[model samples]
Target: MKLFKLNKTNLNEVEQIPFKLEKDIQSLVEVNVESVFNLKFIQSELSVDKYRIDTLCFDEENNSFVIIEYKKGKSYSVIDQGYTYLQLLLNNKSDFLLVLSQYFNKVLRMEDVDWSQSRIIFVSPSFNSYQKDSVNFKGLPFELWEIKRYSNDTVVLNEHRSNSKESIETLNPTSNSTISQVSKEVKVVDEDFHLSKTNQPLVDKWNELKEEISNLDDVEITPKNDYISLMLNGKTLCYLIFRKNSISLEMNRGNVKPDGSRSKNYFDLDDPKKISKEGSWEWKSGTKGTIYKIPINKTTDLEYLMFLIKQKYKNLSN
Candidate 1:
């Protein structure tokens, strides 16, 4: 079958990619080898012993197999193919995993696999009532998407289905970072302004942070002894781990180092305007390191902080 290649260059401006669902499936299979099973388009004889399948997919992570059959538009017979593939794949676990590992470049240990828990993904533009109603669409890993040709591109997109897939959710959680600023050498607020006799610099920075954070519904700030902590949606976004003589405005302390410091990680504490009164600070015993950490709630930047918290400091993902 001849494919409709999109001549346009930019993928961002275009709402859809000019590629068929099969093409998308190919690219997805090529790149995401580690995450997904291998999808191969095969043509096997419909012999009594050897039942052929449209496409075979094996998942190493779940010790599972999936049969993906593509029907042009909406076909009711896709379910029949799915069930047929299921019966055949159940008898050939070793063959599927062996081919899967070779395709993905990883060794799969499938000594005790339960093929009954396998899935079927029928790819078609639409589904009929009998196909939809009779089959346990929710129970099986079947996904339906509408293929559209818009502005010169034929794109296959996955429809958002909110199912309680505990296993899948635990494997990949939603990350909350925007900017990919994980460079350890990024400028930290190294310069210090001592909080003596109404420091305007300190106050200016503090109010700015307070105003910015207060605007977001997730954030709430209140004084805790000499320090202030920022909470986002009941989760502690950051806190001013204030020590009188050695002040360190630690943002995402869950990822703070052995001794509290971002190691010049070019990220501020949760709020730049929330500059605390730099009463007294010291780097070494008497070095006087008056520093305030200004942190932004950038989803991606808190990787280190998240790491710190997960390792020993706190629990965030849970």
Candidate 2:
């Protein structure tokens, strides 16, 4: 895509700056993975078995490992390489856990990770039609991100979303058994999956909340394993956990006043630790600061919830 600079009424074309080496792209992405993807960087050039992963990252929200590969050439096959890395991860779960334990300076058990949410990400300047089409399946656990740099010292990374709705399992059998095995274990989840967990009334409330939150500037609604995250500029504004009868809203406890007093106009905050004891929801790993929960039901005031959400949005924006 072309970029331009507006000078008064005239548009001046900005030259594209090409990456000198694959490592250049890798370093840029590894350094800014958190702000760009909201993922935690574990290690670079992580070697497991005979394969070397370009970058290793963990999704704190989903408690899953993410494999990132940088490419400067267009001849590589995304499907083959992506599944190969995923297969390696699935087979060597212990090695990944060890790495995670070392990085965080704590011991982590296998059951603590959600392996089904594991996936691979491919970053490059451009992807060939064949490479893009290979990941057209809805069930493929892979993401293609195109990164570009301009001479004006600006860089943009955008995800390539596939429009196809076909599932990879429906295709004819292939010779590679790794693809089949990995596909069986790793599943792709969407908004519908989370919405299906609740009743129609709760779903309607979720839609209403989704619409109102989405109306905020540059807000992104992303569905994870257990909740729908409302994010602004890569920082989570709130987590919406759809329950059978009520939608649980999780936000940072810092949203409260400096004097530790709850706002009279907002819903009462419940301690996340206390709620977790009741088996209401699991506290996600890598969550910093204190968190408070607010349950949204039919009797709950929608305007009050939006009011609290708007405050968080404004805080994150600033």
What TM-scores do the predictions have? 0.37, 0.82
Model 2, 81: alpha-carbon shift in Å?
1.1
Q: Candidate 1 lDDT, tens digit per residue, 1-318?
A: 123444596334444444465555444433543333233332222222466554555544344555555555454554455545655565566777666667667887775444544666665445666565434323333444444444544444443232342322233244421111111111111112122323454445455555555555545563332355565534545555433333244543222343555333223234333333323344444333333353323222333433432321122333
- Best candidate according to lDDT: 2
Task: Report RMSD for candidate 2.
Answer: 5.4
Worst window of 10 by summed lDDT in candidate 1: 179-188
Taking all chains together, the TM-score of candidate 1 against the true structure is 0.37
- Over the stretch 1-318, how does candidate 2's per-residue lDDT look in tens digits? 789999999999999999989999999999999988879999999999999999999999789999999999999999989989999999999999999999999999999889999999999999999999899877678999999999999999988887788877667467557788897789888888888988898887777877777678888887788888888877778888887887888876443444455432333343322332111222343222356577877666666777767766776776
Q: Indicate the TM-score of model 2.
A: 0.82
> Who wins the TM-score comparison?
2
